[model samples]
Target: MPVWPFKRSKADIDAKRLLEAVTQTSRQPALFGEGRIPDTLEGRFELMALNASLALIRLREAQGVESLAQAFTDKLFRLWDAGLREDGVGDLVVPKRMRKLAASFYGRLSAYGEALTSPEALATVIARNVFAAEAHAFAPALAAYAARTAETQAGGELDALFTSEGWPAYQG
Candidate 1:
């Protein structure tokens, strides 16, 4: 029998679809409802980082997810690059901007991963990132929402995720 391959073409396709799903979920208007989030570039990036953090963490436990995770991260940065280009950023500046964007994403990922270890920490992170100057009264709801999403994704399969219907509804 042949040895298992390090990369699977099908998995890559599914992962791309999954990345798109996560991206769409992150941009749901409900998340920005009633001034909850600023709905600007920073706000969109923050929400995407949060959703991507949760998805990547959950996806890491699945089989053959290594490449998928990396591809998802790449897709994220590609989106950032495209956005920069659309905003009239010069080619000379794109690389520097991408580096800064990557740093911002990694910083949020580290902070979020650390926070996910405890409810209190998660609340604090959410308050600081999501609410900013406002009170964190919604932290509990947000935490519950994140937990539900993780649980739902954990139970799902890669093929299922390729379909639009596979995505879990945002509970927050």
Candidate 2:
């Protein structure tokens, strides 16, 4: 729960700022240039991956641990796949509306898939929701989703605290 270098809230992360940075960094003759959009799935993943890697480095430093890259990578992928599911047992349930929007974006950008095969693909995944108007507005929810996902996938600890077969269990 260390705050990002930019700000305390995700809103502070500023999609516009991120877009501008990406735009500037990926300009022609730059590594990420040529038909790249910072708002795409692949683009977002790349951003997320970078951020995650940075966070892991910070975490290791704080804990005074030796290279945690492998552990960090393993946990990150698990959290990435679990993706916001607080409950360890179920699929990561994306909101129907968001899912549709994502599908639409993906479909529109499908043609760019080949062009996105670069390292940018990593951040693109993390930044997947960056383009969603609702995302900036609901960043807490998204963070919660990501936190829950990571916790659930990390181990069985949180599971006991959240679920209950109490009273009338849905034994159906």
Candidate 3:
């Protein structure tokens, strides 16, 4: 069989599917509103980072499919980059913006990981990142939701990441 230059690898396809699931979950309206995540661009980005971080955390612990995780992350960033372009962000400035976005994502990932150890810490982190405030009344609810998601993903099969049903429903 001849090599097909344009064919996507299995990992790439799986990653795309997983990314789609993450994106759809992040965009659920229930996640945004008064006492919930803000519906602005920054708020959307924060939610995406949170959902993606949860999936990546589970992926890191799985025995195999490490490449799938990497592929998922690569596709995610590409999607963000495309969105930036669509918004008329100049090519000359996309790199700087992406770098800042990446930094924000990684910082959230670290804070979330550490915060997961305690409910109070998790709420604090959620208030800080998701709500962008010192203390939001609904931050604790969001924290509980995140904790539930992490637990669900931890017990789910790797294939679950590719489907919406794999993630816990948002109760916010």
lDDT string for model 1 (6-35, tens) is 656755676678778878887777667563
**Candidate 3 residue 63 C-alpha distance from true site, Å:** 1.5
Q: Count the clashes in each prediction.
A: 0, 17, 0
Q: Write the per-residue lDDT of candidate 3 for residues 113-145, one digit (tens) a residue.
A: 888879899999989988778898988988898
| C-alpha TM-scores of all predictions | 0.80, 0.24, 0.93
Q: What is the C-alpha RMSD of each candidate to the true structure, in Å?
A: 5.1, 20.0, 1.9
lDDT of 2 by residue, 7-112 (tens): 4333222323333332332232221323332454455554354334323323333333233334444444444445435434345354553455345444433412
Error of 2 at 22 (Å): 18
Window of ten residues with lowest summed lDDT in model 2: 163-172
The per-residue C-alpha lDDT of model 3 at residue 111 equals 92
Q: Tell me the spans in candidate 2 whose CA falls farther than 4 Å from its real position.
A: 1-37, 65-72, 82-172
Find the candidate with the highest lDDT and give its number.
Answer: 3
Against the reference, the lDDT scores of all candidates come to 0.74, 0.35, 0.88
From the highest TM-score down, the ranking of the candidates is 3, 1, 2
